[model samples]
Target chain A: MKNGIWVSKNGRVSEASGLQPRDALLFAPHGMTSEDLLQEQRSALQQNIKLIRTRLAEATRR
Target chain B: MAKARVFISSVNEDGLKPLRRSVFRVLEGLGHEPLMWEENLGPWPSYQNPVEKCLEAVEQSDLYLLFIGTRGGTFDAAAGVTVTHSEFIRAVDKGKTVLVWADAETKAIFFSGIAWKLDEYIAHTVQESGSYPAPMQALDFLRSCQEAPPHIDPYVWLLLHDIRQRGIYVEDLARGVETDWRGYFSDLLRRGLLLLPLEPTIAENSNRLEEAETSFDLLAALLPQVTLEPPHDWKVWLNTIRERLQGRTIEHRYGRWNRETVGSYEACNAASLYRRDGDSMRFISCCGRASAVRSFALNDQSSYIALTYAMGPRAEQVYYTESGQKFFYCVRSGPFVATFHFPAGSSWDQLRYIRYKDSVVSAIIGPNTRLVKLVRLLLGGMRA
Candidate 1:
């Protein structure tokens, strides 16, 4: 059987059947592709950066 | 005149202590009678009919003050019929003046409840600065009302008076002005007019009518601007709202994915831009374990989008983004797939630019991997 991943409805991640433990270990089951995860992380990081910049601007104004 | 009666309703016992005391003191100071369930109820009545008495108190009161706490009981919980909820309903049913106050914490908790959620009461819930003791907040609400001159309920009165003052007459109000002109004229009638023993001549009535007409003209010009401007330019409208709400001291932040992120060459390589139009943009991005897709409009009006994954669980949020942008994203647990949708009024060229960026990122990560090939095909279709 092809090794796959499974993500539970509540966002829990689990490995699918037939994959090697190593490959399974590398994969996450929450149904998010690796690319999607990276993009979301980047989006969050950018938001944090904006927040920090806004805070700094406010501090400087004060 | 008889003292005004007030009913106070709250969910939290611990938080109610100080607020209860403060409300009691303030109302007493203002020569009013203040009633609270915990302080005034002799005991939870054995008879179910006791609820009727509570409703009666609410009906008799000049004002009903609802104190919404951060936590009390679930709406679906057996204790869901909280005093606050009951009093609110009773006050509404009886057509009493009801005031509602809640803080952010309470709002979150209140909204989460299944039974009587905050959204059900949003029209009545007045957002306060923070979770102060309920009684003190109640005192503040009372004092604010006292400071304002006796007028019709502010929101209603403002709408009615402003609409009349602006000269833009609704058919209903125009009829009211014609039939029982006395009822409409009473508000404009001054104390000076009443003091005269003799009835005013036609000239005096004409003068008053002219004054009202001028007032209406000023209101018609200004009120519509106040009502209409915000929907046209939402960004400026939101900023104005934020400014007015600064005293509430709650941070309201909204963010949008800019062209650099959405239209990057890297993004195009990783995602597929499925649809492009003047106001709508749609695309899908995929990686090893997950995929995300969405549709949104440039003008940020009503739009919906969804993403599902091959491996991981999917989640969805439907919300409007800053700058009138709206979209949705979903991801798989292991591989990466992301999709975006822009609606009929959005800038499709901007989406194309984002697809281009994603393509660049795919090239950098893996020159000709299967995932990269898939991304290339997706972007190539967009170009075609």
Candidate 2:
């Protein structure tokens, strides 16, 4: 059975082409400061909230 | 059970003697072969440098039991680290399974992990003493320590507390220790007696002196529990308790606790007599002249209280409550302080409570008994 994996960053998605410096910094394993990782997480959460809001608006209009 | 070579590591200081012994006994009871410097290594000068020998022992051992007490321990001047502290570092570096048991009072300081060495630990202590926030953790640790049970060996408990049910076991174990000091040194030492001619280590003589001092202190603490002159308000409190216990039958009797050996003398004390209810269900409270005997009594009392609450009518929460200026508690096989427990399916916070007082009497009475004399001698010697 394939073990389920938790993807914290997009590194697993594109192994052929390495991530950009900014993306690398955002997804750095240990070197990136705690604040940087937290900021990245916060941004991802904000994007999720925006997408959820858009879907809700469309459902309400329909 | 899979066997492991477990090394018990602690400073040979007075305060930690009880804990070190308890841990050693428990490990052996759990079927682990326990090795300790005191038992395994020969006394001072036999090994040119004992600390290196201890480290080599730790390297060979599979499990390390490290007990941290109040004092950092005697300085190892050559290594510039406390002996116990250095042993802990070496044990950790060697990739052994390290189980660190610390006094609740010192847990915070240990948890900080700030001081890698004893000198730093001492400096940290001084700085913490002068500060507010740092000392807060230490104070909390002390308050918690009071609520925790004294670390005692299961075998020791079987001998001292469960003697009625396990008298034969105690006798057998005592017989084994009569000849072998390796397994039972601390138990015999703390009880205010010792069999001489065990090889003397550097710390052995000073440790014996301190144990004597502690015995005097603990005994002095314990004697006041059997009060012919109960505190002025004790009668009032007892009356209240008696009123609470109106339906329950209470009886009293004078008897001798089973004879045990202390320093070649077969010593027995007049057990303080008090029983509640019929023969089938009775609680015995004993008091005696020997301070060590009273400590055994106290141990038995605490264990009995814990067992009582455990057997029938499960308590939602159990704690020691203060009455007549002493600590009283009935708990289930563990240490608990004066706190209320809220159980389910009950309008009330607690179903039943156990009360025993004079908890702090030992802590208070024992130390002060000799500290004054020591202080006076120090002062006089200084002036001279």
Candidate 3:
């Protein structure tokens, strides 16, 4: 049995699924785990970094 | 004609109340009928199809006014079924006119509820100038509308009117290369194409114009043209040259020939000749060590050369030599043609030979020898 809370579209969280202390959370809204969120954030930051570098290069060229 | 009907859509009632009222007053003042859902809808209407009637009303109206706020909640909940969101969507779908008023500060919050993918639909975001939020600033905005002398920028208004007649992709129009009316209009006119009316505020228009002007000015300065007068039969002469060299190609080269002759050369398997009306003769040659073709124009007994060169390692050189010069000489290292004024009675001995090579490798050639050879090549050519 998966242990984590279930998050609905409206952001309502339900803990119906039961199972252990260290088990991974499952079925949270879009099925995104904490790690997934962190990864997404990391990716967004990297994209922003790339954009900034490109802008800097353009500015220097000018 | 019946006064145009307008429907105002807003997500946050409190934030938009004042705007809603002002909009109503403005429409009424203009002798147009203005309607808002809160004012028009019956109390506690079934949520099942809360937006159905609004969509219907929007369809009947000539224009739809959208007030975008930043917060999400009931607005997002009712998005698919609310009078505001649905009405705007339906109006757009029906090809009705749309005027979007965005509360810049609140836009992020308002849009947060919407899926990020749908954000593109919300274009034309403008910051409100007043100190307060949408509701607080409505009165001032209304007053400004009233006080703003009836003198709308006719050009801007004309664009708006055209937009109404033929819908446009707002995002594309706003982000076009020529942001100002003049440049935008010039581009449109030059292309012989008509664009839909979509007017930015005066400030936005001016800012865009300035940016475009600066960019074009810089480009023009970097590339200056040397003008020449053509012979009376220049065009025919050029055509004859072209006919003679129709099948051959040319190659371009750039390098230092000797100590002082650092420049570029263009050689071709075939050459085309042309004459302009001002008695100018043009020679075009293709196929060389480089990919660029060279064009030589002769006017007033002087020759002007123009060639394109690669910016990187395989760059070309350009040089000029006068007739009777002993050694060929170079003028520049990049892809450019330099014009040489032939000294009185000077012959081909002053002419120079040009070549192309890698910049790093070409640096090894002595400059003095290059210059001497350049003059000699020119003199030799003139004698030949």
Model 1 lDDT tens row, B292-380: 44654433322222123322232222111223232222222222223322221243232232223232222223222223223322322
Pick out the ten consecutive residues of candidate 2 chain B with the lowest summed lDDT: B348-357
First chain TM-score for all predictions: 0.51, 0.48, 0.50
By the TM-score metric, which is better: model 1 or model 2? Answer: 2
**Where in model 3 is the C-alpha error above 4 Å?**
A1-62, B44-49, B73-83, B107-384
Q: Residue by residue across A1-62, what tens digits does model 1's lDDT show?
A: 12233212222333334322221111221233334644564466456555544434432342
| Best model per DockQ | 1
DockQ, per-model, please? 0.02, 0.01, 0.01
For each of the candidates, give the backbone clash count.
Answer: 83, 6, 84
Per-prediction TM-score, please?
A: 0.26, 0.26, 0.26
- How does model 2 fare in lDDT? 0.36
Write the residue-wise lDDT of candidate 3 on B43-112 in tens digits: 4456646556667778888677665543222433323233354555577667675766554433332234
Q: List where candidate 2 sits over 4 angstroms from the true fold.
A: A1-62, B44-47, B109-384
